[model samples]
Target: MDHLLPLSRVAKLVGTSRHALQEMIRSGTLDTFDGMVELNELLRAFPDTKWEDDAEFRRITEIKERAFGKRVFERALPDKEVLAARLFELGNEYAATKALLMHYSQVLSWLDEKIDEIEEDQNKETRHALHVLRAFIVRHLAEIPPDAAKVQALIAQERILKIMSAHVTIKPSGHEFIVESNDTLLEAALRAGVSLDYGCSNGNCGDCRARLISGEVRKVRAHDYVLSQAEKDSGVILLCSCAAVNDVVIEANVAGASDIHQQQLVVKVKAVEVFNPQVAALHLLAPRSQRLRYLAGQSVRLSAHGASGRYAIASCPCEERHIEIQVLRNADDAFSQLLFSGLNANENIELEGPYGEFVLEDASTRPIIFVAFGVGFAPVKSLIQHAMSLDLAESIDLHWLADEAGYYQNNLCRAWADALDNFTYITHASTTEVETTLANIVNDYPDLHRFDVYAAGTAAQLQLAKRVFLKHGLPAQQWRAGATDA
Candidate 1:
C-alpha cells in the first residue's frame, strides 16, 4: 500500500502537535489524499522536520515523489493526446483495434435506441423521421469550412433577437417600463407614464440625463448635447437617444406629481380677502371636470385681462378643485395692481400649469428647515399643510421673514406652531436680519448634513442663504431653493 499516513501519525512522526498539522491542512499549506495526508505533501509542508533524517521516512518520501510525478504527467496530458501516443507506441498490439470497436459500439447503441423509440410511437409519421435525419445531416455538414459562415450568421441573428426583446427597470423607484428595440428610453418612459425630467424631445438639452446603474443600453440616434468625460464614465445616458439592449436598472429623477400634462383652464374667482393693506389672498375654483392635480409648493400662471403673473399656491394639495394664492401688492407694478385691485369675485381668469419642482420629498426622514421671505411663504404654507396631512413624523422648523409691512400672517404661523407638536415657527421682522438668523441657525445645528433645507425667497436672499448653508455642512442634494419669480 502507498504510505498515505493519517494526520495523527504524520504529526507524531514529524515531532509536531496534531493541532499544528491540522492547521496547515486547514490553511491550505498542506494537501491531503482522501482524509489522510500524502507523504510528499507532508514533506513539502515541513521540509526541515526531524522525520526527514530517519531512514524509513527518507525511503517513503522518495517513493511518494516518484508516484506524484507520474500522477501529474498522466493528468496534465489530454485524453486524445494520451490515446494517440499509446497507439503509436503499441501499433503491434490490438490497442487501436480495441478503440475502433468501442467507437462503433457507441454509434450502434445510439442508433438502436432511436430505432426503438420510432417503432414504439404508433402515431409517428414518415415525414418526422425524414426531418430528424435531415437535421442531423445539415448540422454536421454546416461544420464544413464552406458552410461554417452561414451557421455562425444564424447564431448571431438569434442572439440579436434576444437582446432586442429585453426590459428595463428603474432603480430606487422600482419603476419597470418596457423599451422597444427601436424606441428611445424617453419615448418608452413617456409611453409608460414614467415621468423623467426632459427638455426638447431632441437631444440638444441634457435635462434627460440619467445614470445607467446596471445592464446595457445603446445609442439609437445622434445627440448634440456634449457630455463630460466623467459623466460618460459614470454611466450617464441621454434618454432621448438611448435604447435599452438588455435588462437595465437606471437612476433617474422621476417626479410623480409633475407627470400629468399641463392644462389651460378658465377658473372662476371664488373669493378675495385682503389680509392687510399690503397683502391679499385670492381663491380660484377650477372647473369640476378639469380640476387641477398638483403637488404642494408648486406655482401657477394666472392671467386676467392680458395681465399675467406667476403665484405660488398657498392651499394644501388636498383641495384639488380650489387653490389659494397669496399676492404681495407691488405699488409700481400694474400686473400686481390688477391682481389685487382689478380682480373681482365670480370673474373668470386664465390659469395655466401647476409648474415648478418645489414639492416635498416624502422619501426623506430627516428634519426639515423652511425659510420663507415675504410672499414666498405662500408655497411654504402649502408644503407645511401637505406635510401635516401626510402625518410625517420629522421635526419641521419654519422661519418666516418679511418686511414689517408684509408680515401679516403671523397669526396663521402662530396657529400652526400651537397645533402641531413637531412644528416650530420663528418670524424675522426684517429681510436685513435674515443673514444673521441663518448664521445663528447654522451655528446651532453645526451638522446640517442630515437636514432637508428649503429656502423660498428673492433671488438675492436665496443666493446668500445657499452660500451660507453650503458653507455650514448642508449637502447640495439635501438643499433646495425656489426663487420667487421677479
Candidate 2:
C-alpha cells in the first residue's frame, strides 16, 4: 500500500516551506499524486534528510510558537476527549495492518510447503529451481531494507504531528490549513488568512455555521447559539465551538472584500512605535468580544480625543485582535500629529470603516510584484504578510521606492526576504526622475504579462506606474492599485 501525505504536511515532515515544495513541483523535481506526496517519493526527493534528527523541524516549530507569544514545549494540546478519539483511530489502523501482515505471512508459509511438494514430484533441474526460489524468498524476507529505520522515524514523526494537529479543507473555496494548538476551526482559518464569515467568535451568533463534508469534529466549547435538528442532522456545526478530531473537509462561506460589512468598535491604544521624526506606527488592541473584521490592504478610520483620520492598515488579519496602522507626520492631519506627539498607550480609540478594495487575488498562483512608494508600504506590508500566510503566490518581489523619510522598516522587509524562499526585496532611492525609475522597473520584467502587480502610492504616482507597466505588456486587469496620500 502506498502512503500519501498532503503538500502542507509533507512540507512540515521535510522541514521546508510549502512554497519551496510548490517550486519543486513546478520545476519537475518533485512529483505529487492528486496534490499529495507518496511516502517513498518523499524519501527519494530528499535523500540527505535525516529523518531521525528533527532539529530543523523543531527550530521551525519554535519560531511559530514564538510568533503566537508562546514558548517551546508549551504549545496547547488537543482536548482530552479529542485526544482519546485520535488515539483510538490510530489503534484501529495499527490493528488492521497487523492482521493483514499475519495473513500475508500465512500465505507465504503455504507457498513454501507447496513449493517443496512440487520439488519432490519434479526432475533434478526443476527441483533445483524450486529450491532456489524458496531460498530467495526467505533471504529477502529476513533481511531488513536499508531505509527501514528512516521509514520508521518518518512514520513516527507524522503520527505525532497528526495527534497534535488536524488538517482542514474548506470546500468550494478550496482553502486548506492545519488546526493546531487548541484553536477552533474558525480561529485556525483566521490565522491562516482565510477570511470565513463570523460574528462574536465565542459563538453567541451562528454566523460561523459550516457543514462537515467528511471526517469528525468534537465540540470543545459551549455556544449560546442553538442549531435546529434538521441542521444538526445535515452535519452543520459552529466553527467557533468545535475542533477537528481528525482531517476534515468543511463547507464554509469565505468572505470577500465586499462581503465584509463595515464594523465600528472602541479599541485601546497598545503602543506608538515612532520609526522616525516623520512616521510612526499606531498599534491598537480590540476588545475580546468585538474584533474588527477587515482584510489586508484595507483602511480604517480612527478617532481619539476628537481628532480623526483615515489610514491604511499595516497589520495582517492573521494577527488576531492586534491592529497596526502606520501614520505619516502631516500638518493637515490631526491624528498624525496626535500619534507622533501625544498618543498614549491604553487610551480609548474609536475605530470604524474598513474601507477599500485593495486586497490580494488570493486564488491566483501567479508571481506577484508589489510596488510601494514611501508610507504606502503600509498596505503592501499587510498584503505581503497575508500572502505569506496563504502560501499561494509562486514568487513575490517587493520594490519599495523610498521618500525623504527613507525605508523606516528596512530591517523588517529584509527579515521577510531572509525567511521566505520565494520572496525578494529591492529598494530604490528617492529620486526626482519618477518616470525614468518606473521605466527601468518595467524593463526588468520582459515577461510582464505572466505576473500580477500591486502598487500603492499617491494618485499621480499610481497612474504613472500603471501606464508604464501596461506599456510593458502587463495586462490591464492584472494591475491592482491602492491610493495613498503619504
Best candidate, TM-score: 2
User: Tens digit of lDDT per residue, candidate 1, span 108-218?
Assistant: 668756766666654558647755775785576457765345434433432333333345667777555545435678766654445566655467878789999987677
TM-score of 2: 0.92
How much is the lDDT of residue 83 in candidate 2? 90
Residue 176, model 1: Cα distance from true site in angstroms: 20
Please write out the lDDT profile of model 2 over residues 1-486, one tens digit for every residue: 889888878888898777789889999999999888999999999989998889978876665545433122334788788899999999999999999999999999899889978888799999888989988999999999999998999999889989988998899998889888778898889878899988778878898999999999999988999999999999999998999999999999999899999999999999999899988999899998887888999999999878999999999887778999998899899988888877788999999979999999988888999999999999999998888778878899999999977899897788677666678999999999988998989899999999999999899999999999999999999999999863
How large is the C-alpha RMSD of every model relative to the true structure? Answer: 27.2, 2.5
Off by over 4 Å in 2: 23-29, 60-76, 113-126
Per-candidate TM-scores read 0.48, 0.92
- Steric clash count of candidate 1: 0
Error of model 1, residue 376, in angstroms: 0.6
Quick one: RMSD of model 2? 2.5
Query: Once model 2 is optimally superposed onto the true structure by TM-score, how far is the C-alpha of residue 242 displaced, in angstroms?
Result: 1.8
